[model samples]
Target chain A: MPTPTSSEASGPLAVETVGLTRAYDTLIAVADVNISIPKGSVFGLLGPNGAGKTTTIKMLTTLLHPSQGQARVAGFDVVRQAAQVRQYIGYVPQMLSADADLSGYENLLIFSKLYRIPAGERQQRIEETLSFMGLSEVARTLVRHYSGGMIRRLEIAQSLLHHPQVLFLDEPPWVLTRRLAMPSRNTCGPCGSAGGLRSFSPPITWRRPRSCVRLWLSCIKAGW
Target chain B: MGQTLAVAEAEVRKLRHDPVELLTRAIQPTLWLLVFGQVMSQLRGISSDGVSYRDFLAPGILAQSVMFIAIFYGISVIWERDSGVLYKYMVSPAPRWALVVGKALGSEVRSLTQASVIWILSALIGVHLRLELGAILGMLVLALLGSAIFVTLSLIIACLVKTRERFMGIGQLLTMPLFFASNAIYPISLMPAWLRVVAHINPLTYLVDGLRTLMLTGGSSAFGLGLDFAVLGLSTLLLVVIAARLYPTILT
Candidate 1:
């Protein structure tokens, strides 16, 4: 029930959900939730399974309608201005949304076309995205052949295809551990010979408006 | 529009990754045509018109194929919702209508592919094709519009249900009834009075009737074509509006 603070009012908020509530019959999935996410930031909606993180993200992104209240993304109302809102955000859902029958590059091409990236620039963008995710080599391979980690990476790459102004990461607690367990751990060069080094990289990095980050960090630390 | 297209493109690409799935989706209808159509022909009194059973069965199978292809349209949405891809679409800047349109169009594209293959196979099996450019174009339009209606129906169902089991259960419950209730399996005149009423109301009946006219009669009757087009067009418009309205609400 936290309101958007004065500091967050200074810039364009990437996502704002006020009094958002979703109910099915008598079951309340997400109730009276309020949040504000700033532009250009990676916003993590973290909670236990079925904690309404996914539902909340859906409302903010215009996937699900709120039973009460409103959600706006990138300065557009998710309900009233949904098309404009969708044009500005990138969404990567908890499950693998990519077509397993398609090759990596083919998948990217489809998204490029959907996002209406200029026809002229689509090829370059596809190539760049594939390479960025280290998927260029496997670009021709069917996604079904992709490893679990590779699938997640490809999902991330697809979300960034259009360079969405706000990114929502609905990280279920279990998936977080698995994603963090990947070999993103880098050792200091000087300590390489010592066969050990502290894990310098945080398990996850969320980038959002400075004020929202502070509030988000505090919430995470509080174990909400 | 752009983002919806992107999601659709992704959906199409995913199809390539699973060749077996694509093969099954494409080949199942052909098998039905080859086996079921041939078997059903052996039954006495199956044909009301002078048309041979194979000829009579061809357009019906085509309509069925369109229905089958579209039935899975929302399967992707359900899978995406479970996998968080629906969440991605929800959060992205793409318009809700684009998402609906893109998914519908994507399903139409797949349906068209399967329908074309069936058309080719029918020709090989000696089922006559009118091959008039106008007829072919008309068939494609009908198929696309019909596919869009079915796909939208699937999306609405997907949005309403949360689990895959429930989605599949509801989908199965709806599809076959829809097929049987229509003129897809038999002519409306042959159906019982009560069932005939259902077929008259079933949108698929108009689609099948239109396709049959195009394939068999070489062109639809002016009245028949007008009724078919009007029903399909009106249904598509209503479904699109319902889908657009339900889309954002469902996300929450």
Candidate 2:
């Protein structure tokens, strides 16, 4: 119930971490670290496997509390103001996040409901998101039948449905740029300009022939 | 409550796309009625108090089947974790309690479907049932409550174990004791002193007692309707709360 105090309500940073740390028993999974990402820009956390990139994203998204240190997402404290943080962030983890059992539209609908999208706007938002992700064609197709890249797009669409301020994809494929380029249409471009989203994911870049938002890249190695 | 229902609705929708799964799951309960019920009915020593043994065992089998479905539900939770679906839910704005309750509510839908099948099978097998509106409604409530309790318990197990092997082992260990200790198959009078104590504490006992009373014409509850509901309801609420608290730990 703690509301984000001070600049958190309307800060320039989409994400910031100071001495952020997460440690397991006798092993530090994510050590003391600091990071800052400004609004309206993309920041990618780049590292090899076990570099704690997913763990860091998890902590910032309020899915995993930090073992020690301070972290904030979209101006809200990840731990003390996690509910507020969740409202402002969309997260796609490293693994396949889409529910394969349901159709693509059904998966988005469920996310829409979970995100508490306004009932009146839910349909419109879903359509826009599906189109944005180029999933409109297979909207009714079972997700299980979709290819891995299609599933990833649907998962991205799910995160974007809420129009989160900070969109985090833990480990999107490097070819995501090509995937997002399928449509010459401006998809994430509008959100970037509207102050609705900041992309955060290493190995993920969205490039359309017409427009692109540049990214700042960071790294964590061996739990550092 | 809306978020809770949304979580539950997602589950129901998944099954809705494949209704055959529900019917397929009913096969076990059908076997229980057609095979075990008939085979056990002829026993002379088991006291049924006048209502036929098949009729007595029908509710027990239904409750057992519900337990069987719910107790191993942790495996799915683990699967969701492995598949990364749990991450989507964990990071959602919905509270942990709502997510747990929502999953439990979905299990109720599954349990009720099986209950309907058991009702039809019981009738065909010549078990005289109450079939009255009030009784049917009561049975529905009992099944839902029972399913919620068991599924929530399953969720807690999922949180603690967080692995399929451990969860399956624990689930298998639980179902047998939960079944034998309950007054599902026989009167509580038949249990040993210690097991009678365990039966008194088992939520499954209350479910079977309520189901037996509501499903059959001559069926009666040893603990009375009020007590049966109170036990199941309170236990369910408690388990749901516990499971919700534990839900986040699975991620850790």
Candidate 3:
């Protein structure tokens, strides 16, 4: 793991983990992991199939509580200030998180409301997000009828509807086409080479897309 | 309140894609009212004075139908968990109880379709319902309140059981006991000694009590309307809290 020196990436930390660990009853899925992602930096956690990438994201996103150690996102403790963390971070899970029963626009609108975007700005924000993700044409289509890639884009649109400070993606471009992955740049590309919105992408070896940016790779081995 | 309404708005929007579900839900209530009520109303000792068995059973079937609609709300929660829609909600700024109640409120709106179906059917069959605007409005409150309790209870079950298969089995396990043990089918007076105790403690009893008083002209609450509302209202609040706490367990 390449833990950057202070001079390498200097800014308020978008994400920081220290001795982070998660354990099932008898097995530790993620053990004593530590990484500090400075705001405006794009990074990925590379690992194998059973390498605990999903569990780590789940903990950082406040979806699951870590068994040991502590981590924070957007300057808030993932556990103690989880609500605040949620306020500042946008997360798109690997699974099909978009509601199949709803149209793409409705999904984004619901998320916009949940994020408490002002009512006046919601329509334009959702429209802009749909267009930004290349989903404007099919905005009225039910997610149930969408192709895998379209569904993935809608999910991405839902997360970015809030303009969060940091975006945490479960496994972007995992099983997705090339064009499907770049919008994260629009949302995450706040910083040029030095800094911007921080994104945590842990691409599994089998599913990593060819176009993945290789700015920095912190590889976690199996059972990590 | 804004966040809670938003979560509910999302869930409610799904019904637009499948409005037929509301019509289908009305089927069971139809059977209970037309078939079961007709047969049971003939029995000598079932209904109290001045109330025919059909009129007596109208509100009960309405309560039962709404209960049936909401009691399995856990299944959808399990689906949300699997599809990762739940993860989005979980990680949102919305409060957990708000999520639970918002979801309950959404499904409760769908249950009203069944409630209205039963109401229309009750009027058609000449059950002599209290059709005044106020009574019907009051029924709306009771129906939503009744279904909200079941929805929150279902969410609690979803949080505990987690998986779809187990949730289905437990959902089935709960609906019958919750239905039969409550005053939805028969009055508390007709229940045996042990079940009478269960009926008193059952939140559905209060719902039925309130629904019965409001739905029928001559009907009155076995337990006063105040007690009925107090019990169901408090129970919904309690279940919301419990479901919210157990909600994170779904991720495991």
**DockQ, all models:** 0.47, 0.72, 0.71
Candidate 2 residue lDDT tens string, A1-224? 22233354666677889999998888898999899877656565656678788788888888888989998777789999999889767777878889988999999898888888878888998898888778899999999899988998898889777766677777665445456644343333311211222332232333221222223233323222
Specify the poorest-scoring 10-residue window by lDDT in model 3 chain A. A204-213
Please tell me which model should have the higher lDDT, number 1 or number 3.
3
Model 1 — TM-score against the truth?
0.75
Candidate 1 structure lDDT: 0.69
Q: List the global CA lDDT of all models.
A: 0.69, 0.81, 0.79
Model 1 misplaced stretches (Cα beyond 4 Å)? A1-85, A91-99, A129-132, A172-224, B1-7, B26-36, B39-44, B217-223, B248-252
Clashing pairs in 2: none
* Alpha-carbon RMSD, each predicted model: 6.7, 5.0, 6.3
| Per-candidate fnat, comma-separated | 0.86, 0.80, 0.89
User: Which lDDT tens digits does candidate 1 get at residues A1-224?
Assistant: 12243354334776677899999789999999888776433344444567877677767766766789988766778788777666666666656776576778776776676667788887887887777567899998888899877787687678667755555554423333344344433211111111132212213322222323211110021132
lDDT tens readout by residue for model 1, B1-252: 565666666656555444466567867778878998888888877753667778777888888888887976777777766654565555554566887887887777688887888888888888877888998898899998899899998888877885678889988898898899987766677888999888888888888888887776443332388889899999998998788667754444
- Candidate 3 segments whose C-alpha is farther than 4 A from its true place: A1-11, A174-177, A180-224
**In model 3, how large is the Cα lDDT of residue A141?**
86
Better structure of 1 and 2 per lDDT = 2
